[model samples]
Target chain A: MSEMLWGIVFLLIALLVGFFITSPLLIIISPLVEWSALMPYTNRSKMTWLIFFLSVLYLLIFIGLVSLFQSNFNGMFSKELALIFLSIIVVEFIAVRTTQKSLYQLYEQNKWPQE
Target chain B: MNKDLVKIILVTAGAVLFNLVFWNEKLAINTVLFDAFLLCALFFLYPNARKSAAVNWLLLGHLVSLSMVVIHNTDLSKIAFVITLLLVAGFAEYIHRSAWFASGSMLMNVVMIVASFAESFKINKSKPANRKGIGRFIRFAIFPLILVIIFFLIYRGANNAFSDIANRIGAQLEIFFSHFFDFFSWQRLVFLLLGLLITGSILLKSKLDYFSTRETRMNDGLQRSRKPMRQKRNGAFFSFVEMIMGKMASGMMALKNENTTGIISLVLLNVLLLIVNGIDVDFLWLHFQYKPGLPVYIMVHEGTELLIVSIVLAMAILLFFFKGNLNFYKRNKWLKYGAYAWILQNAMLVSSVFLRDYYYILKHGLAYKRIGVLFFLLMVLIGLVTVFLKIWSRKTNYFLFRVNAWAGIVVLVLATTIHWDEFIAGYNLKRRNTVELDVPFLLSLSDKALPLLDTNIVALQKRENDTRVINVNDGQPACDTCFIEQLKQREKQFEQRQKEYTWLSWNYADAYTKQYFRKRGLITSIH
Candidate 1:
């Protein structure tokens, strides 16, 4: 009974830590990147799909890491470590796209007349 | 006529009615005192209601009396009666808008009824006031009174029901208080305080504006007017937060709800497993020299596996919530399909466990071994399939992949049910042999020594045969030749033991046997 209780406590702690580390990135970066990628100058549809694919791949990687380390690691560190890696990757991806938003808008303006 | 006095009367009456109907002697007195205090507090808080005290008191008294009578008789059934009265009074007040006293009385009655009913139902449905001659008068005079009466009745009914049940089933109040304290041990309390701190920070960030005014009569009118203003003040943040919270909370709630149910069921299963394991362990420890079979170990293994599964499932739910608004499946059609496949696999795993348990119980007369193998297989299958699906969904987009995933789930469930009885029987035989060895000394005693000893043995043996043991040795254990041979062995042991000692001299042995049977929970003494 004690072991079971400890396991639940550990899992909750790990998840909470993961949420704290990820929430700021989700609030600031992800939406901004999605908004920028929809600019007319860029290939909006393709970019959207690319971003979506990358997110899925990142999630899958994290899922894999969690399963692989489930038995080897004890307590919060194992789960939190995997989630942090996933969150960082997402933040970097979103930052890259947002930097190019103005360029994409200019390109869309140039292409609109020809279309 | 002072409005403050009227409001006080209405509120007090509502409280009194609530207490009489719902509260037991102990709780009723407390409720009545609490109500009186609340009335005084409200009046002091808003003094403008002083003019209409008489009408307010009259309405309050009526509401209290009606509520007590209705609630004390039949709790929930009086809802219709209370609702009908509110409707009648509301219409009457609407017709007599010019008479402020009548209108105040009606409104007070309505508020009292609604408050009382709301407490009982835990819902907040209120009747709108009518503005249009006779309708206005009727509404003004009776509507408020009716509302007060309804609220009183509901509060009384709910309180009474909870108290009565608590009293009858032993003092649950004490148990609840103890459990509550235990639940909030220092560490848990600290966590709760931290959670509250976070909530406070969020609330502060939202910056809610509170209503503040000095005129008592105007304050009541102001509260009604401020409803729309309050909504406007927080509309954007409210909607945005609600949208985000709803999505996040729903996923978490679903997972939490499912896992909670699963954990409860799993705990019950574990307790059952523990009892069976303890009996077998005790038997093996006391009697047999050799180690028990794989089936015994298998049962323990299954219990551990189920516990692990429940934990994992619960964690999965927690993770889903913590992930925030990132719903991969909902955002992408392909991922949704993958999620559906994953759900199917999970359902299959749960069903397989149920089927396996059913099979084992049928074969083993509630012994542990019969159910162990099935649970072990289920756990392994679930772990393997989950990982496989996660990998496969990433690699393949073929329609056939989906088909195969679903097919695997169906096959897993079907196979468990098909061979359930045979599997159960194999385990039961192992358990029966363990029991016999454990209680060999008791079995050897003379018939006169333990008056019901022979009957107990026969009944146990019969149950073993009738239950899962028949499947052991391919049903050969119950065959005529095997049955006769087993009976002969028992008869020989009985005679040998009888010659060795008299009934009175075997008191120590008798006591030991009784203890063993009690521990096993198999000794039905009434027979």
Candidate 2:
């Protein structure tokens, strides 16, 4: 049981370290998130609306996660801990990669304005 | 890969590093390094900023900041540290890139960043569709992963035997998590983000597309009112304000129809001020006899405040009378002289105020209010001088303002150098301290004054002992215990206060005084 728990701990630490290392990119891409979300189509006002919705949704998700985890949990690696850690890592990776691809496509589009 | 990225990275590093301020004070060195980093960031952001004396001034500011951290605390170092902040703003303005203040650079950078928000955001949509596989994999894995964790926790909670196994896991987890929890509470994380925002706001550049030239303009009335005031065409809010103010502006317009009323009022105001000054001269100075029972402190206190307000009013009156056509049009020469006569009399009134406050300070004891009155007098003197210069030079009111602002900057640089705690302690603890030595007040002074207090420690201890004996003999045995308890309480208070004074607040006066006392074996070395 001890060995199994240590294995899980190591994995979680690795996941956090990964997020920490890439946080700079995430900070830079955060303000540009609306572009990626609305890239498949083009409408300035609609993108603004989507940005607002995304922010609200993120706030709700964050609040919900905090409420669930901050309460008493009876295990070393409870469902609350696992979900919070995993969700954070997933969000970081997704945001970073999505923003990177979106920005690169933007550069390409700027290069070929005729399109 | 890009210049923008390089600049952004440097700024981000500075932002992130600044948040570690609470972790350890020795990391103040990081603040200096980050300031240097900011210059480079600014260079990239404002490519047009050329080499000038201002750059040297900026470098001097950086060196001053560095010395403030490294050098022994001294009398002047505290002031120099504050001046460094002003110089940084001065540096920005000197390069003609921003106003000679932080708000200008802060606002400019914020606007620059926000302007590119949409353009930067477009990058998010630019991703090729082929990445759908990776996206699909993430979406596919996340939901069940969450569900599995929930199920696992619920299963463990249901069985009593599961806790025995979990305790073993708890031991494994605690070791890894302790270090994490030690440094990061939710509060610290919030401060960390705030640190980032401040850093980015100060250093980030949205664009470097233009060079700022001196002629481009400053956001002040002097520059705007110079080239023939134009009609408002920008927006409704401004036009509305203009429409309302149009009548008032015409009242003080360059061309005037009602000069007699303005001129007659100026003459009467000057006569009234002269009477006030003559009476002050007679009673406060000439033919003055001390009344043993009369309260003189109120004269100094109330009189200083009243005199300052009077001087300010005197200047405003001059400005109102001499404004626009009254200044340039030749018919109001007598009115201008009356204004000058009133100004000179007001100057004398200021002098009387200074004398009264100074006497009060010397007779009583040095305190913050005494120093504050002195500073107020200095400002009033500057205002009076500016008014005289405006009248004699026949310069625009805007020009007068521009000059006064610079004067204020110089005064500000001078103001920050003072170590008030030490000054007050030393002044009060002088020979005059024997008569009315407020031991409680002396003790309230900062640790920087500890050395001064230590020099007079024998006298102070004797005083405290005498007070305790007197109180105890007056049928108050509790005073004996209270004195000892007070000493213990004060010692605890000093120790608590000592913890907060670190490199961030390191100064030369404190260092010198601390060293003086430590050498004499009065106390332990100042931390």
Candidate 3:
């Protein structure tokens, strides 16, 4: 019911749709996490687990797809294209997930002593 | 029904179009078709944007420039198409908000597009009533979907036996999935992202209205500020200038002295230009002759370059003199007259440049630089006219820039409407008897001229033979059959490349060449 729960829910949806349907859809989690960070009841532990699961989910799917289709790929250019796709995916994962984690850590580090 | 839903559909459709049309091909009709789609999307999304006549003109310009890509597709036309795209997007977004300048609007369009991605992260304070429905869908539907995918992938990768079993169960779906993922290659993915960005940039208006608010405060007309000039903190140079002027440095007297200086400078410059123009009229205009081996390298190239630089310098001088309070001076009539005479003389100088280029073109036939000189001269003429308008109406420097920028864009776009390679080939081949047909130059033209060259192979061979004899007499070694061999090689290469192009990369000139080759049985009719 809270904003935090909604954010977690969208993150899960983003991870699912991104791995199954399209990788670009994974970008939705960025804004969701950003919005959730502003909420009062945000739980970093649950958010971390979801983010971890998201990356692992993508890696497994990527491995499965490559194993199935790598031989079917036609040329050196196709393999290079797949590598580029993987590189971009890795960059996106780092850019969105790692940046959010650092922001949460930064928030905790900068908290007042009394709080 | 929802605007966001419509936006998503438009983005998906645009990405699909991008993937299908531009997945590794040269720009041609496909670019024009894509632009038309963007324009249609713009109109549907921003219906009121058409009410702005400026927006309508920009859209037309965008379409015209984009159409040039289909017609000939030069570097100039491609650049113009890109610039016009930004102008159209910027104007459509801020049509009613500001008196949009081309450069500023383009910059704002880029900024807002990039900023919108970040702006999406902001929390929407206004809550919709259907939030509970979305929440229910996510909790029930998304939660299960995510779990199924995670377990499916984990089990599939962790155990090959399970993977084989899963593969058997999903063999039909695997084929479909593989077929679908084939579309997600890196280049196509990049294209899809580009499509999303372009669609989002034009369709999603950012909250940052920096240019709009700033341009709203600006006016085209310059008002005479009666306020005293801000006194500079005296550097050594300022004090030295003030000391040199004595009593004339500080007030109305300074304006009078400046006006006198401007009038005297313009008078001297006008006299000098008159002498130059007189010489040009005598040598380049009336008494022009194409002497074989007549140092044309110096006559046309150096002469035209010098004259253009002088004309540009003359404009700079006029802008300098009429920059500020000099226009409001009571004794500025003589200065204004001097400027008018100078502008008239500069116009004559531009004509002289045109004549020089024309004579060169007549003698040597068409080339890129000669055509470039014509367009550059046209832009200079337009710039001169805009400078005159600025002085007459007390307009700001921005007005001059705005008008001239549009003129430059229109000229560049119009320049690409004709295939220059074909024109050059036809012109040279037609005048092979009178004009010095530079066989090597013709060979260097793009493959668009293949049809013309093939038809006039005999004329080209004759010219090459004449050149070879001259080279032999000059004690240089020259090959007899090398020219024809090179021509044949070029023809074969063009044929091979043309046969490979699909409908997505079609161009009029290229298609014409293909048809020509096919008619002669050089290429088969299958493609």
**Residue-wise lDDT of candidate 2 within B195-220, one digit each (tens)?**
65555555553332223333244332
What is the RMSD of candidate 2?
A: 10.0
- Most DockQ-accurate candidate: 2
The lDDT ranking, best first, is 3, 2, 1
> Which stretch of 10 consecutive residues in model 1 chain B shows the poorest summed lDDT?
B205-214
Interface DockQ of each model: 0.01, 0.06, 0.05
> What TM-score does structure 1 among the candidates reach?
0.19
Candidate 2: list runs displaced more than 4 Å: A1-115, B19-22, B26-50, B53-102, B108-188, B206-254, B287-297, B321-323, B433-435, B461-527
Which stretches in model 3 have alpha-carbon errors above 4 Å? A1-115, B96-100, B118-184, B231-247, B289-294, B473-478, B522-527
Candidate with the larger lDDT of 1 and 3: 3
- For candidate 1, lDDT tens digit of each residue in B54-112? 42533354345334322221221133223323322322322221123233444443323
Which portions of model 1 show Cα errors greater than 4 Å?
A1-115, B1-292, B300-304, B307-324, B327-330, B355-359, B367-527
The TM-score-based order of candidates, best leading, equals: 3, 2, 1
Provide the TM-score of chain A alone for each candidate, in the order shown.
0.36, 0.30, 0.33
Candidate 3 residue pairs in backbone clash: none
Q: Is candidate 1 or candidate 2 better by lDDT?
A: 2
Top model by TM-score, which number?
A: 3
What C-alpha lDDT, on a 0 to 100 scale, does residue B363 get in candidate 2? Answer: 63
CA lDDT, candidate 1, residue B289: 33
Q: List model 2 lDDT by residue over A5-49, tens digit each.
A: 566678789889967975674454455553433332333322333
